[model samples]
Target: MLRKNILLYFLYIVSSIILLFGLGYTKNWENKDIIVGFIFLGCYIFGTKYRFTSIILLVTFSVLSFYFPTGIIYGKPTEAILISLIQTNKLEVIGYLMAIKYEIFLSVLFIIIQFLIYQITKKEKNKFKYFTIFAFIFLYIVSLFGISVNHHGINRNAFLKNSIDSWKVIRKQKEEQRINLGDSSAIKIDGKIDNNDDTEIRVVIIGESVRRDYMSVYGYPNNTTPFLNSAKGIFIDGLVSAGPNTQLSLTRTLFKAIPTENKIHWGINVVSLANKAGYETYWISNQGANGWGDDVFYNLSKLATQNKFLKAGDFNSGNNDDEEMLPILEKIINSNAKEKVIFMHMIGSHEPVCSRIGNFTPNFKLHNEAGCYAATIEKLDLFIEKITKILKGKKYKLMYFSDHGLSVEKTEVFHNNNIVEEYEVPLFYLDSDIKEQIHIKKKISGLNLLDIFSSFINIKSNVTDSNYNFHQASKITDNSDPIIYWDEYRPFSTIQKKQPPIKDIQSNIIGDTVKLENNYKFSKECVSYVDSVDVAFPLNKEVYKIYGWAAADKDKKPLDEAIGVFIMKNNQIYFIQGDKQARNGVRDHFNISPGERDDYGIVSFVDKKYVDSIKNTYLGYKDQYNQYHICIRNNQF
Candidate 1:
């Protein structure tokens, strides 16, 4: 049989796998399925005259998997692919297709391989006919194993049926929402407003990924916000977003979060009420208008009088600067509209913080990733300064608040860890009317944002309590406001909270200078010195996080961005860019000082085989004052 046509067989399998995972990445294939789906595929294989049907199905699904995996890793198609496809522009679809050109080419190869297999196997007794059955069984088991272990997994032949099922579910949801919206009348506001001043300017800024814990104005040691610190404003001590992510926070904040039938109701929002209240509403954004949770902004922005977006999509690409929206805002300010309620959205520190800083030498600087993060905040500050300067001599009340906060360990940021920090956002109001700054020391849950925002914008509604309270937002205030984390409203009393370190409040020591020292081992009791070191085995990503602090250093004097973390495996040395983290208490042993110790991390992810193979490994970093430190964990050695 000429080596059983091995080349053709290999090509066919490779092409099929490519198409399977490729389509998964694009979200064209369903990622979860039932065993009946496999039986259906087998039926399709047996019933179809084209024996190559299985190969075609596999190839098509692989392509879908690949496409959707890209989305999963990058966080896209959040609502659903069908919804995205219905609303998305054709250019994006073409761009996605272009992105998977390799997969498409491999799919074409499946056709060629199928032709060759049919030509060669047509006249034979088909001795290898069970190959398809064996392959199907192997894939089914593998997919089942994956599902048992991980939350996201797709079985064999889940490609077509499950996708159609997902499509139908999404379709039903859309149709239901449409009907619900059509049947339900929008909540109306019929009353007089206090927005009589013709020249009053109200500016609201929505910050991205800026946690209040990281702000100097909010008692952070780093002084990340210089402008807000100096500005006389109403500093909200306890202000939290409705949800952790951009979509959840904004949707619930902008609209009434009255859920009906597992679907968010879009009835009577701040923007709609503002429009109804005869205020000239403007939504100016320096962030991408649509992507991830951006559709929330896009939908509400449509309700504004005039809207301008920096980009259509391409979120977190970091091409947009908050300062860019200033000019358009100034234009809106110069307009003849008497009472203007302007919503300015800032990309005030989304992930990959370095990109947001670009080439500008940040006035507020720190070491490595911290500086990048701070620089983005500073950029936003500068934007605020410029806008305030432009609005000088005018009656303006500018309010700024972050959508949610990010958790920083060393240098790397966990976008959302369900930590309390994710909901802790700074809500500051700079009113030129008040001569002194006011601090509201009560944490506010944005679940009541609709009424509060209406009050802030002077959207008087008979439906809501028109009597405005300066301290507790509106009448819909909570005595003990709870935040929504992982879709559950949690009280602060329930959460295990870590107070800011004494050093964090007492010290503001951040330096920029490279300091190198040889690697030094610490005793088991790492803090205040010597104890016996313990040894273990199989170094991997999960364990690296536990012992990673050993690789990092904590110094008052910080090093510049070009720091490197080196790891030794046997005699071979590997150098990493060193994404530093200040996270303390690896496994309940020591409390790290923020100003004194630079606790950078030496983290790596290796395969299970390599984990056992790595024998003598050393991890270390240099402090600003030229001090060398190495964490000698007994486990890996």
Candidate 2:
């Protein structure tokens, strides 16, 4: 019996080690994870004599351990998971279960093994003293403190606490907003309107998760925004959004909040201001209305003269494209109301990009995922064109801007927490009457959008700051003023210090020198090369050049071999590629070419005339082999 017990104990330890290592390998092995594993292991071993308690504790720990890795791997935070749990329907839950069927099976198997080991050791005497229990509890408390205070590692306990706190704060804010909704005195409009009979029609378009760097009009290599490029408007180049997420960004942008103000009362929004201005306000949105209960934006939409929500369900429900709101928009436009303001909120380029594109054909040649994203952009461009056509003869001014931007890192695109790219969105103003195409050079914040709107319709509002109004002022009052971005996890009331300018590989150029390095490994089974050089072809004029190469041993390579030149001239990006075969594919989708290349035996060069057009350029390259190499030289070519 003693020998049998010894064998069982050995198996249990071995199994535990195997499980820990397996999980560590699957998830990235972190020191914090190791510490957590040991803590759990000690509890399991000490509690083995108490069979039932041991089984329960081990099972719970195992489940949590599995979920921790899963959540981290998928980039799902505790708050997001909680939201999904509360909001997801039974069918959706079942679908999720089906998707993780293998993981569920593994978890069950692990639990059973632990149970059997505990059952086998049940007859043994309760060797562990009360001190073992005390020690376990003490260590667990210490671990919790370490997790909460350190903040460097992935701590599930800390994450759950933060998530719970965030939810509580949201609930409190929602309650406050609900109370504010009833307070008529909370919203004050100190604006005078010149009641002109010309019927000024103004449309504020709110785009979703659209990065400025991805649009062709903003100088993206692909012609994803042909219609926008041709449209006559004021293109504000450096308008950073207030936040990375939609809810946070829109709340701040649409409301009248000063830089130093902390508490923002709901109901006093753009819609309320427009309503007070005697303009027939319309709120047309393709985003779901029922998902967010008592959300400030949803409640504020109630203030509109006419409000229409095309999508009734949450994100799990069907996605109705932005184009679906067009018919409703036409109805609103045809209404006989004088001096109107329409807020057209679009479901533009949301994640799961393929679903957003629906049946639209892709206009850019890329990998399947990237192609889907590009297709959505093209679809949005077309939607804008259609709207412009409808308002052709009317006296209207349309302002288009995204609520927030997304980030594309290492070819995987998603919403980043506090990256500059996540807040950098496109802002353009197109008017039937104003023909001059102007570009604002200074950095601006979306927080001042309310002022810009007031200036657009010539409404005299106390909130209107002439210095911040793009339509009224050509330049910013203070060019050095910092554009603030909020930390993702913090409360909306807390103010984060202004982030310093993000130094991209291309933007960090010094004089006639171009030097950058990109060590992004695409895959393990490929050979890749990246090289860049700065040249003064005309001796006095400077130009930059870059080259990329990739080759796989097998025919089915993960990435294609490509070479391109990226030019930043006058705050616009110009991309020129080298290979004609590659250009053919690109042109098929974008309808633009990189210009003819001067083909060398093993290397290719872009046309000198095109190169001469760009005064500055930067280059970087990465391939499927997970290899990123970059080099920059000053007047060496």
Candidate 3:
């Protein structure tokens, strides 16, 4: 009896560890699963026979897992996360808390279920009870075996440490660094441009959370790209996103693959290069500071003669519209600056499309995969139309495509994995002055998106320092560079290029004259070193002053714009005038990270009074006892 009890306790402990580690794999129910799994195994071992305990724990775990993942990764703490949580059903800060709360509720439910199980097995005695215990052990062992087999490096022990899990801990660490840096380190202006006579304004509309293939521009049945349909731009017809997420996709889109055994951070991207070429580079964005690598974008913007950073939540009050560009574009066009290159990063076709539509609901309201995605596309079409009209009279070139495509319809748990549609995007380029300048008339994949930059500036560039590169069958069809792709676990690579069998089609679209002979095929390869350290903008003193914190000129005039504050205290308002030095009455915000400042973020003057008032009010809630933040608009905090 003593030996049996010892064995049972050992098994229970092992099972609990397994349960805890397993929860990390899922974005939901991580904590509660650990507790319930512990309780259930313990009760069963001791013959407690209380089903209610396990049931309640299970429910509570599930609920908490959902909401705990809602905090913004960077910038000052705006009610943005909190308010968004309250208003949205998609995902929010409160949603995570609620998930935790409900996990507790589930634990209670599990206890009830256990009682039922006990009542059913009441007639059984020694033999039956031993059989049941063995069965539970068998199930746990099987699960542990499968998980360990698939992810060999992962185990119950490693999951317990906050710093061990690469996805959870490493991702958080990177975010912390980004928050402190305050996102102004991405800029790189090497030299001055003597000649600026291009006269044609080129606008690259960087979209967020937009999936290609779903857009009407990509020949979908729905009219998602209605704005681009009537507008003057070449829809490349054969463009696909490099990755599903912004970081990977942007890296793939901007950098070209190089042949090196070790990974090296090749400093300065195409954006920085553009700034060096003398074109006025302006980054007008509608996303948060840390979305993608806004630090990169923020730094790149400063390199340009003119730059603007606009927070999405402020202007739309949560809506994302193409109309938002009207005023900004007008301002640029009205300026006497001879040549311009505007990079407009839109909150295009992101999830919660309903927030983007404002009070106007979609004609079709089916929440199914096809219906919801189709509605989002249509909403984009409306905004595109509005933006096109603004570009009419200016000698401008417009190119619009998504960073990555999404899989909204997948019913499977890991639907985003191995789906071609997730990476395929409709690529198009519209030119007002040089319609005949387009060289490739065939299906040129978006693998070499950065190559377009070379064409834009009339400069021939190899620009190959990334995993993906531009490849045209007629030009360079070499598949020597390893292709890096991502799954749920980690990034994988492939060496060979296998073009998909192509089909013949015809259309009157601008770039439709070029026929695509083959389709782009997905392959995985192996690369030597996955880790790299490139030159990063750490937002050192020079960058801060350029964006209006320290001093741009000797006179100490703040170069950037307004200052914002987020109060941790309840019912209190925090305010700072200009993005300059700390005044007598105002507080001096310090950097939380080594290379940047996160306590204060960038905000516009429009939000000053409201944010200040709220922070002042925050003082009343001393019990909240959390870190609050301040954001300086249009500049790094």
Candidate 4:
């Protein structure tokens, strides 16, 4: 009876697990997934005394369902998903959650089933009597230390290890900041220095999140780069960036990047090299450090003689415009240093685009994110134009290049580096001596940034002189080397090729921006506010964002496109078509179906643009049938 009962109990436990964990995967099961699933099973079966651990594991596995991939835990240093999660800001986290709400819903249900199985197997505690406490300890030891040794950053135990390793990178980078990077002997680099007898200035403008295909100068339909389009310079075509993200790309671009199996060795950087060559270097930036403070750009920024970080946080919030550093630029340019190398890091365009626009406003009507993207490049053009004014009559050589380009897809525009557009960035150099624009017929890799920059600055070195000669552009312009893909570090050409299409934004915003004074009228019965308007900032007399529930009252069915936000600016009508955004009270107020979307919620950025133009702005909306109706409780603020 004892032998028969034991066999039955063992069968029950096996059957319960097969039923619970098996149902989670409907089809194709990966080996890694099965291994992870079994690991969880082992923990639950062994910990009979602590049966409640199953509840904790259920939550953990559910979260890991979203995170567990081949590369996240044990991938390349900066490109790991875990590293990205650590680097992300609050707004980015919010945006990503909203984008993947459906995936999150499914993951919750999967892990709950595993928790229920623990209750079913609770009566099997008698099975644990044969095994001593040492068995449980041995099982946990193998799971923790043994798995961690095999999979340093991939296993469950190695998650903490990966996070700690990332911070170690941060700590290691912080240590680099302590050294006198500006001192020539500190770096101990072998390079020839030419002390210019006359006054001279060297400017390196590092642009943010800009792709070559999006620029007007590069045949883009939009006039996003009007100033650069006419500017006389050595423009290189098909210039690939070092890496996709700022840290990975710039660490390799600005510094001597050696990608070893263990880690990326950030050797002597260009700023330190410049310092070694006897140039008074200054790093003035509108770009923020990695995760508010980390290895991101802080390591390279510290190498300069004089450095100042402009943006306070991740540079995802507010307007951290390039113009903010212009005052400092003027100070540096007018300084008594005979030879100066100024590195200006501009926040050209980071993700969540609307926040970055200072002088240039986002035209939401013509593609919200794309318009903001174009505006950032336009702002950069104006910045360069202003820079030319600052350096007027001064002996100066200017060079500009972006850290990396953004993804072409609208939904996820950041650098996972899965597309060709992500690597396609701008690289150019111009000096007072150049009379006409000389487009380098051949392509080049941005990994050669150190060499190209050194050559442009007339740095006497065998590396620079051998690879490129700025003066003799025609015969010896064969510096085109192959670039490697991000993370993979394989030949970039081997990856799938995808070129971004020309996204022609608002024609006016692209060309000379002039507001159309449209005579758009609104009838009083269109939109109704509940109480006083829910203007975001009422205290400072700033009324930009107005929130209220709107509906296609005439239409029986609420198509998402039926609702809209109408703005009357300069006595002209501008309407932004509605998309699905949920407000808690919207469905209840409208008495809509649970299956139907919450289309009634309305929001607009009327004050996102020039404040004076929006001074007399009246907020209203037009329904799908072109019937214009004004809000009864209108924006009187």
Query: Best candidate, TM-score-wise?
Result: 4
The Cα local distance difference test for each model comes to 0.53, 0.56, 0.41, 0.56
Please tell me which model should have the higher TM-score, number 2 or number 4. Answer: 4
- Candidate 4, TM-score vs. the true structure? 0.66
Question: What TM-score does candidate 3 reach?
Answer: 0.50
For all predictions, the C-alpha RMSD in Å is 13.1, 14.9, 23.1, 10.3
RMSD of 4: 10.3
**Alpha-carbon deviation at 332 in model 1, angstroms:** 1.9
- Flag the better candidate by TM-score, 1 or 4: 4
lDDT of 4 by residue, 1-637 (tens): 5874465355335433332232232123345544544544465455544444445544444454454222222232233343344544443444345434333323343344445455554454553453634555554444333354544522343333444565777556545544533333434434433445243888999987888888778878877888889888877776788776665577668865544442443445677667767788899877655563234467667777889877655555444567889999999888785689999887677665545675564332333346666777777788888898898898888889998887544222444466777777887777776788877666666767777777656565533433554555455445445565354566667546685654755422211112334334555444434221332222212334444554444442333444445545555555554333444234423334435665555545343443333333333454466554555442321
Better of 1 and 2 by TM-score: 2
Worst 10 residues of 1 by lDDT: 529-538
111-219 per-residue lDDT for model 3 (tens digits): 3343444454344344436655555554334323323455553223222232224335334534543443223233433332214425467777776556555665555
TM-score of each: 0.59, 0.63, 0.50, 0.66
Candidate 1, which segments miss by more than 4 Å at Cα?
1-185, 192-199, 289-296, 312-318, 364-366, 462-637
The residue ranges of model 4 lying beyond 4 angstroms of the native Cα positions read 1-37, 44-52, 55-127, 130-199, 260-267, 289-296, 312-319, 361-365, 410-412, 462-466, 469-481, 497-499, 507-637
